[model samples]
Target: MFSKACEYGIRAAIYIGQQSAELGRRVGLRDVAAEIDSPEAFTAKVLQQLVRAGLLTSVKGPTGGFELTAQQLATVTLRQIVVAIDGGDMLQGCALGLPQCSAQQPCPLHYQFLPIRDQLNEVLRTHTIGELAGKVHDGLGFLKQFT
Candidate 1:
């Protein structure tokens, strides 16, 4: 699971990447928020975090907006975004929120959760923004819920 900001951050990145790669254009904050169905203020804050993390670029003029370079789209992984917004503990935190929940002092579900957590970490580390955006561009994935 991810924090609300992290969830929106991921969606915003995917939408921005999809637009940039498919249409070759930068997306304004309003457009990004609309596409991802997130509040403009919250999305702006999340975007700021991504921008600070070097996963996104922002400009200020009328034609200015947000975008990721081709290199960034190709190289920025979900893990990076998650860490940027949620911190490195997103994947490493104990499932039960215990202060000491490691193998030596395992929580009730620590052993059972280890494999699942490892798998999730692997997936996040390997999946790129470009790959996910490409899926949306190809109509195989979506960034927003459909009614």
Candidate 2:
């Protein structure tokens, strides 16, 4: 599963993508956090990581904030966000915390979970935040109808 930071990071990325697609311009963090319901402080920290990882662009001063760079818009996959916040090891490491657990020496859940894990990782690696936004923008199915 994803951590709160990872969840927030994804939400932040999605919000930025939606704004960029909707307004055709860069977006600010205070606005993004407010739109996504993430804490401004926590979202700021995640935004810093995203900027450092080259997944986002940040400007300073009165008009400064954050936006995804062109290269980032093209290539910044969800895996990068997950690694930036939670580390890639969370995906590849032993699920049971077995020090030496691996494909050869399986954990209890390895057989059942490894395939699912591999599929999930592939999804993260293959999809960009922009690609993900298309899914979110499609509307939240029945969930949106309620609110």
Top candidate by TM-score = 1
Candidate 2: where is the Cα deviation over 4 Å? 138-146
Give the 10-residue window scoring lowest on summed lDDT in candidate 1.
88-97
Candidate 1: Cα lDDT at 90? 52
lDDT of 2 by residue, 102-122 (tens): 779988988887888788899
Candidate 1 ranges beyond 4 A from true positions: none
The 0-to-1 C-alpha lDDT of every candidate, in the order given, reads 0.94, 0.79
Question: Judged by lDDT, which candidate is best?
Answer: 1
Local accuracy of candidate 1 as per-residue lDDT tens digits, 1-147: 899999999999999999899998999999999999999999999999999999998988989999989999999999999999999875997989898899899999998999999999999999999999999999999887788
Q: How much does candidate 2 score in TM-score?
A: 0.88
C-alpha positional error of residue 28 in candidate 2 after TM-score superposition, expressed in Å: 1.9
TM per candidate comes to: 0.97, 0.88
Against the correct fold, how does model 1 do in TM-score?
Answer: 0.97
